[model samples]
Target: MKAGYVALVGRPNVGKSTLLNHLIGQKISITSRRPQTTRHRIHGIKTTEAGQAVFVDTPGIHASQKRAMNRYLNRTAGTALLDVDVIVWIVDRPVWLAEDDLVLERIQTSAAPVILVINKVDRLEDKAALLPFLESAQQRHPFAALIPASALRGHNLDALEHKIMELLPEGEPIFDQDQLTDRSLRFLAAEIIREKLIRSLGQEVPHALSVEIEQYQTEGKLTRIAALIWVEREGQKAIVIGQQGEVLKKVGERARQDLERLTEGKVFLQLWVKVKENWSDDERALRSLGYAE
Candidate 1:
């Protein structure tokens, strides 16, 4: 009856969200090649024959010019580190260790039985070439269990699950079977919209963009949601909107399709782009956007 929490910590876009979704057997978190796709702490609960595993999916750790936001996110990430039964440090399979990778080395030594989950192994066609990367990762931290897996393709995930179960403390299920994720429907809706915008626009825009739900109501057979997508500059807004509203329309349609599936009803999604003029610097805006401590 082993049950406990496992914190998935890593640099941006190392497949932390994807690996969490895979472990939970559901899309509890969104995935994107773009870094910092996950802005908040999302809990994904997994119920198996043995026990339950609650995976805390957090924002990626990176160097931030915004020192306050960086400190906030870092503190949040560090908070998840405390009192967890295990820490799964996700790393990219193709790339070896770097100077920035030392952050994990310094922060993770205090964690109990830190496990290294080398993700995106599917990208490497040659398994032999991955050995060096794996070896280099092992040297960085004394991981309890080191496993190479592809979160997108579910490769070697069974091995990952078995190892995780073996490492967790024994107990009963913490969350109910009916509960899958900790996020509310509105929060997910906003994140879905943000995911679409990030994917469509690519790296032209910064990650300081955030979504806020303005109005949410249910009308018989449909959901009415009005949301605002806040960005830093007018140029970024134009990139998100595309030429002659085509890009914005595409983003909205894509978000709408997913929302319909999630809500199992008609979805009316209204997304408006607004420039908040140094929203990152404003502590109130940061807190409102769920980025604050």
Candidate 2:
């Protein structure tokens, strides 16, 4: 059987997390419309009769390196290129950015074959434009394959999966067939809370926010979790907490709903907003918050 690791590398907001979730038929990684939503290397394992594909969903590669968190995310995404059987380089429909070129340069150094995926084809009003774009992309590098797909609409994804499986090296399945992801429940719980915050809060709040699970316990059929939301300043904390704690309460409710759906059990979630004083720029603080590479 064919089995191997596939690294999904692309610039921010390219729908890498969305593709991974759809491919595995589950949500192994959290996603938001905001850039830099994914900060960790999440493994989503898909085992079919043909083979097992271990997909590594990484943080978006970007040009920003102002903070320790930015550097860590780049390092994590860059490191994922190594020791992989194939690389799926996703990009927005028919458009390439300077950041895409930067990501391409990094992927070129890797020995694995790369597949260029033109994601969000559903947004393409002119289907004829795809050919010229693909030709131009081909002129840039020798890609293993080029596919126009929509991760949101489930368009051509099976074809993409088939191509990935074909490129994967032959081997036995590394993970069990029933396994969907490598992340723990606690980690997913924290990510869910962060996602709620990102969706509910203002644009600037997402960059300043991080979630830490303080305590997790199971009582009979219920899972109780306490999470700490870290912000860079007192003002950010106040913004997150909102008037009469309404914002925090809404975030908690949304997170608990998602956590219940994910765990398939009742969840009792508690959230607290705390100031970390520019933790994103502080290496020690970032490490303490689990940003170490």
| Top of the candidates by lDDT | 2
Model 1, span 1-293: residue lDDT tens: 98998889887778889888878776778878887778788899988888888899888777664655666666677677778888888878757446236447545656567888878888878889877876776786777988888988999999888888999999988889668887899889988988888888866575767889998888987999998989988888888778999988998999999999889999998989998877777777788777754
* Candidate 1: C-alpha lDDT: 0.81
| TM-score (C-alpha) between model 1 and the true structure | 0.92
lDDT of every predicted structure (CA atoms): 0.81, 0.93
lDDT of 2 by residue, 1-293 (tens): 99999999999999999999999988888888999999999999999999999999999999999888899999999999989999999999999899999998999899999999999999999999999999999999999999999998899999999999999999999999899988899999989999989999888989999999999999877999999999999999999999999999999989888889987899998999899898999989988988865
CA RMSD of all predictions:
2.0, 0.8
The TM-scores of all predictions, comma-separated, are 0.92, 0.99
lDDT of 2: 0.93
lDDT for 61 in candidate 1 is 76
